[model samples]
Target: MSSQPSCSQTTPSSATQSIRPVSIKQLQTLGGASGDDDAL
Candidate 1:
């Protein structure tokens, strides 16, 4: 029972770790584009 819960917890964390970087990179790209437009 304890092991099951640990496994479940780890699964979501690993999934999020994979997704979070892609999301951050996309946001950074969009922010940079907007910032450049604002500067001009």
Candidate 2:
């Protein structure tokens, strides 16, 4: 159904949103935002 696909898409969307900031923060902790793009 439509709801099934919406949920599937939203799950990854939410995860990516969470990871985007987390990745930057993690790289910042490791060193700096220099490798942020590469990390992603």
In order, the Cα lDDT scores of the candidates are 0.98, 0.87
- Which sections of candidate 1 miss by over 4 Å? 27-40
What's the residue-level lDDT of 13 in candidate 2? Answer: 99
Model 2 lDDT at residue 15: 100
RMSD of each: 2.4, 7.1
* lDDT value, candidate 2, whole model: 0.87
- Best of the candidates, TM-score: 2
lDDT of 1 by residue, 1-40 (tens): 9999999999999999999999999999999999999999
Judge candidate 1 at residue 16 and give its lDDT. 100
Question: Number of clashes in every candidate structure?
Answer: 0, 0
Evaluate residue 38 in candidate 1 and report its C-alpha lDDT on the 0 to 100 scale.
100
Q: Name the TM-score of candidate 1.
A: 0.53
